[model samples]
Target chain A: MNIIVCVSQVPDTTTKIAVGADGKTIEKNGVKFILNPYDEYAIEEGLQLREKFGGTVTALTVGNDSSKDILRTALAMGADKAVLISDSGNSDTFGIAHSIAEYAKTVVPDLIILGRQSIDYDSFAMASMVGELLSLPSISMVSSWTINGSSITAERDIEGGKEVIEASLPCVISAQKGLNNPRYPKLPDIMKAKSKPIDAVTGASVPARVTTVSMELPQTQRRGIILNDSEHDITELVRLLHEDAKVI
Target chain B: MKIIVLLEPSGNSIKRSSLESITAARALGATSIHGFMYGGDANSAQIAGEYGLSDIAHTPATEYSSTAAATSLAQFAKSESASAIIVAANAAGKEIAPRVAVKLEAGYIPDCVGLALVNGLIQGTRPVYAGKARIAVSATTAMSVYALRPNVFTARKAENATSVNVRTFTPQLSESDTRVKVTNVIRNEGKLDVLEADIIVSGGRGLKGPENFHLVENLADKLSAAVGASRAVVDAGWRPHGEQVGQTGKTVSPNMYVACGISGAVQHLAGMSSSKVIVAINKDKEAPIFKVADYGIVGDVFDVLPVLSQKIGAVTGK
Candidate 1:
């Protein structure tokens, strides 16, 4: 089996989000970049699947030259090879997915995996778009997966409960959290990753479907108004909710 | 103007979140509201008419899937020259909206709690930083795409609605187009999941053991609320992944969110701070949850939960 996992380099989830001086875009001056956590789950799942099924796992990402560091990390995680879809700068989820899907057409892997969504942009739509662009069976919010001879089964969490679905081979799946406990890279593997081969592919020149005009911080909550000591304050609080807050 | 609202079928009926999107679309001066459904049964068209939609576009999928449905809808949106498209910010919408946005080169906004048209421009108020803050944004593109957050806008029944005009479109797709195949789906047997619940009762590390989650579950049953766990609780495996509410988990905006024995982590607060009424039951008076809570009881949850459940039961007859 040949398994291909798609990943993206995004701002670290722990990075402090700040608005630029123009108050419209995320401030990039001090932001640190890292691999999206969801992609980590995808990579780990791919590696485990490859280990069990005796196949090769290739980790793929689309970004500028700076994103090679994330690919290196994936290589250290037991992937056989890494592919970087290089671009001039960052691309929206659609552009990136389109390029990946076009590349997948040539590779024709048996299974494709990606995170349910990217943590930084959190668009959560790229995997589905890639599935649509390829006309492949797709599943989202997958918690568990098992592969049969020519079919695969996955567990998906819905609003009320879970749904068990089965599809044929050559399917695409976007994994959510808790699918598996992702393993960290060891010192030996990290050193071995230096010798791993990474191929750079130019991304597709698709017109950007959406453009972010500006990104501003959400309105901050005001400091809490402390109530004076008294049981009577409960009534005042309820009254404020009914009148001022209008949430009751 | 013609506004198309993409209605996803939930179970045997239409999701309530789609009605909220229709409400917002109407505010944008939609003369004719078109409801689009994929892999949906015949009742879906009728349900759309009940929601005040005048036209319904039905695209039955051979594969009975969301990807096929989205491809069909994207074609419909382009052919009809739709000025605006509205969808619910649920799993299906989250998957399909961006695909349509990319196909049509439309400006897409996700998790919009409210929408309005100001001076011929559509403005959306969406939550950021989990649910701690709401930011208003305007689309830079010509056609606007919006995904409405669930439970923010109440869905009202529209009386005397006319029958919908239905049309079917065959999706154009290739085998290579369908790369990511869904191999299987597993369902969990339980009560309401956190994302769909109207009220949620959540716990944290304050609970001594995983076995003690029954206490929280008991209160949840009393209020017909879903049970949720903070990251600490989830990491401990007290509950399944579906029950986790935080930055790394599912983002929820319920009507009433009750936190029991939880010390508010910034990540946890990001997921559920947008709840309409926040009630915190914690022994520590300085717990961060109290800062955002509408009502806080400083006491042991073991004692407070029983009394609170009784009070709520007496009022709600549950």
Candidate 2:
């Protein structure tokens, strides 16, 4: 089996986001960036698949020089190789998917995996986008999957239930949370991965079909009312929920 | 401009989210709104007419395949000369819309919270950084695809009875296009999923242990709400991952969100800050959940939950 896992870096979820000077992006000066949490599961799943099928797992990403950090983490987690397609354009989901699909064509991997969605954009569109670009079968939000010969069976969540899906090899899958517990990189592997060579290629200059015109913080109109848990307070809260909030 | 709305069938009727997509499409002031679906009869989908849909198209398929559906939907939109396509941001929609956009060479915007027409061009407002920030976006492509977030747009019914023109659409599809298909569906019977629930009662570490989750469940049952959990309790194996609500879990915007014993981490807030009303109960008065909550009660869950449950039951007559 030949597997390719796509990964990316995102601002830590806890970071306080602010509008950038450009007014269309987030401020990066004081924010902390980390490997996207969902991608860790994708990398781990790819490594597990390689272990069971006896093939190589390659980690791929599209970003600038800083994205190499995530590929290093993937290497630490047992990926056989890392590739970075350098691009500076942001807010372009289609452009990024095209870049990854272009890279996957060269390797001709049996399986391609990614996180269900990136935390920053939260579009949840990459797997199907890349699958369409490559003309391959794709599944998203896969929580559990089993491989039998060339056929893959997976379970994914929907609006109120789950669906058991069947697909063939040479497919795309986007990992959802609870898929698996990702393994932590050890100190020795971390040291070895730091020196691993990363193949760099220039990303294709695909123009963004979607563009952000402005950005702002979400305005809060929540009425902050605090009370104690006394019997009187409980009654009052219920009353407010019925009359003021009108939710109950 | 002609707009196409992708519809999903739920047993007999169209899914509420898809109806909301029709509502979103209507907001664009399009010349016409057409409803399309992957596998279902046109008769059962006639209910979409009440939601401002001018026409409905059904293409029957035995199984579910995102690629095949995208291919067919994109082709239908092209044949109709649609300027935009609207779909609900459900699991299947998230998977299919982008592929349709790729095939049509259209710009796709996912999880939009608001939509407007500015100078006769449709623009969208979507949340990024997990609802911490909002951005206004537009399509550079002539054709655009927008996936409206579930539960945000209200599905309004037209005052007058409107007739729908229903038709069966046949598109050219190949074997390779539908290589992936849904073989079986597993339903979590009798449980309200947090993602679609209007009211959710979530428990946290302050509930002490799995044994104490009944308090939360009882409260949820009395209030007719879904049971949810914080990451701490979920990681501690006290609750299932499906019920977890946080950044890494599920994002919800229920009408009322009740957080019990949760400290309201930034990631947790990110998942649910769009909720219409928030209520928090915690022993530590300074827990972060109180800040965003519409109403809060400062007390231990053990002491407060049962009383709250009984009072709610009394009011709801449950």
Top candidate by lDDT: 2
DockQ each? 0.30, 0.85
Point to the candidate with the largest TM-score.
2
| Alpha-carbon deviation at B189 in model 1, angstroms | 5.0
User: Estimated TM-score per prediction?
Assistant: 0.87, 0.98
**Alpha carbon lDDT at A223, candidate 2:** 93
* Candidate 2 DockQ, CA atoms: 0.85
lDDT tens digits, residues A1-248, model 2? 99999999999988999999999999999999899999999999999988888999999999988899999999999999999998976639999999998899888999999998889999999999999999999999999999999999999998778999999998999999889989999999999999999999888878899999899998778799999989999999999998999988
Candidate 2 per-residue C-alpha lDDT over B94-202 given as tens digits, one digit per residue, 9 for 90 to 100: 8899999999999998988899998787899999997889999999999999999888888888666488888888999998888999989988899999987999999
Candidate 1, residue A207: lDDT:
58
Task: Tell me the docking grade of candidate 2.
Answer: high
Off by over 4 Å in 2: none
Give the 10-residue window scoring lowest on summed lDDT in candidate 2 chain A.
A86-95
Model 2 clash pairs are none
Candidate number achieving the greatest DockQ relative to the actual structure: 2
The candidate 1 chain A region of ten consecutive residues with least summed lDDT is A222-231
